[model samples]
Target chain A: MVSLYFLLFYINILLIGCVLVYIYKLRKLIGFQLGMTISMVAGGFFAFTSGIIFIYVYPFHFLPVTIAATLLGMAVGSIFGSFFDYQTLLSGYSNGLMMGMMSPMVGAVAKNSFLFLSFAECLFFASLLLVLSSARQT
Target chain B: MILYLYTMLGINILIPAVLFLTMKKKRKLFTDRYGMTISFSASLIFSLSLGTALFFTLPVSFSVLIFISAAAGSIIGLSYGILITFQSLIIGLFNGTIGSLMGTMLAAVIIDPSLCGLPSQFSTLLDRNIILITLFLTLLSLLSSLLLRFSYRV
Candidate 1:
């Protein structure tokens, strides 16, 4: 019975993954779609660093990834969040709820609080793109 | 006997399945090199600590060794959660706490079912449980990677 439950869960996750990929591809083919892929990626990295700090050093107590997710959207945030959540769960740490609470705190200390840092990163990239495009135009 | 095996298999499947589903929607989010490196390093550390805890079993040395193992495991678990999962502190903490709790719980429930009495037979049961959980988690991890790839296209 447990095995059956797990098998069903695994299948569901796989199906979801495939569906999301299909949608992503379709969006790409259509044209440029405003999204938060870069931020999400950056956030994941930030979470990783924070995790290390928490282990080896003082608990940095911030969550840049959660902030990114909030800024970007829940789908992206949850995806990244789930990864972190699952890893912690597997390792026998705290619950997901506790981790969520820590997210903003971690973000605050990481020298890149969500509100200001994400905007800055986004703007910087946008400007860089703009400059390159203008240069091409010339 | 078969029931126990099935239960263990279920745990293995559920964890990975949840991980895969949760990760699939935003696979692109994990593309950052920093997150991948940190997560991998953390996982390695965690695995090592757990290994040490499992292999060593001297009465005087056990407590100290287990404490160190717990600390190391927490660190690695947290790091993996934060970096690889894209800054999800919730995940980091959860990973650390859950990893420790599960290890202790397994020892208590499966290994030492009788608090007052110590028996060698308990060790065998504990070992079996550990193997089952580990196998399940590995499968889950593999599936998670595949899901990540699939989600990346979107």
Candidate 2:
């Protein structure tokens, strides 16, 4: 049987690719609403960038680490002005996939630390949310 | 609503869950994007709900709690008539950990010193085991629904 790490790595990459394709096809629908498109792109960018960062900085801190960032990105994007659109759906799924395949290595640096990661992600997402959303809206 | 919550308790988890229980026929080259979206979001919400519960209710700390919740959440996600694609499982596991992490933070607000960013004694009364766990678990589970997908391409 294949090791969980390698399995997750390849699978996450595949998911990311599929999401990109979906985004490409739904570009018009996403673009229809500027707010949703930007947020979706922001989420995807965060997910991809965070994945790369985790692979380098903390190779073992896969899922939660990357997910924390992606979720933060999505959270920020949605707060701006979310709607039921292709972009919104695809972005959420992409981020979800990123988190799912996050290395499955919960014990790399620390296990319990994920709580902290969530806090950090929330902080970042909240910060981004502040910028994306107005006091009246959010 | 109650059925979904019961799944979080791992009580009658096998029954009403069948509502979300789905089976995958195939992942086609030209797959129905909307359907995939439905599957992904459904599993995500389920994993997130159970994961948050695991972290909030368990006697363990965040590290251990996350592992347990992630495993259980992934299982719950996989059980949803998914085609068992590797991609889907990854997504589910991610939801689980993220949910657990959120729960841990909510609890840590009063329990974990390094967390909370507040004085523990100030919130001692709010830190009761049952109360805190129940409050955190319910709030997270319900709030997570807002993130669920409702619209899909038909």
Candidate 3:
């Protein structure tokens, strides 16, 4: 079960990396509004899922997990937002911070971390797919 | 310790106040996109910093903290968003409220570990962590505000 969790964790990271590449390739085509929304959603969900996973893996180290997750969210948001305008960056950064801070609590409260993580991952994937389709539409 | 927290709160409040004045002075010069961006970012960081600082200073009542933070967030949103347009107002208000909500929840969990299902044995460590997180949040807001101001020059 632990190994399975680790596998899912790595896959998620890989997916995020792929999305970043995809965004970078089409950055010129994306409008500022869409770009802002994309960055905000992408950064937020990534941080949130990662936070939950970290908390689940190391239930004892709440302090480090919280700090790490927050920073990771900020970094991801800034990186994604940097592709477009400063305004996009601002929106993305704030959204990621909020989600990152909230994720651990949500994770901790769940009775079954594995099931919750799977559900959250599905949501994250769905959101990313929506973003990608919308990006393509534009 | 209380004095330090109060000072942090003051700084957080002062940031948005100064930004509002500056934006008001140059309201006419702002483009549509810039106005929306400023409205969104300023209200968000303002509420976030305010919520966190308030929670840290007075970790007394959870319900009260949530109410206060949310109210402060909405007010900041209205003040900043109203300067631009109805759309900006909606954006600012939604983001501000959400930011404060998250901030309150984060602070709550940190203050009381059991609230998040963590073991509640590290009381001393938790106290120190709160101070560190508060300082980190203040610096984050400071950096973002500086960036916001710098955007005007660019």
Best model per lDDT: 3
lDDT of 3 by residue, B1-154 (tens): 6888889889988888887887787777777888788877778777887898988887567788789889999999989988878888998899789878877877777778888678775667876777787888888888888888777766
Report the candidate with higher lDDT, 2 versus 3: 3
Give the DockQ (C-alpha) for candidate 1: 0.02
**Model 1 captures what fraction of native contacts?**
0.00
Give the Å shift of residue A75 in candidate 1: 20
The local lDDT score (0 to 100) that residue A111 gets in candidate 1 is 35
Higher-scoring candidate on DockQ, 2 or 3: 3
Candidate number 2, chain A TM-score: 0.36
Q: Which ten residues in a row have the lowest lDDT in candidate 2 chain B?
A: B21-30
Off by over 4 Å in 2: A1-37, A41-76, A79-138, B1-19, B22-32, B35-45, B60-64, B84-86, B128-154
Poorest lDDT segment (10 consecutive residues) of candidate 1 chain A: A88-97
lDDT of model 3 at residue A126?
A: 99
lDDT of 1 by residue, B36-72 (tens): 4334423432333243234222234546645655675
Between 1 and 2, whose TM-score is larger?
Answer: 2
Candidate 2 structure quality by residue, lDDT tens digits, B1-154:
2344344466323321544422333334224443344445555555544554555445676578767766766665555425545555556555545544543443343244333222234344443443434444344334434443223222
Off by over 4 Å in 3: B59-61
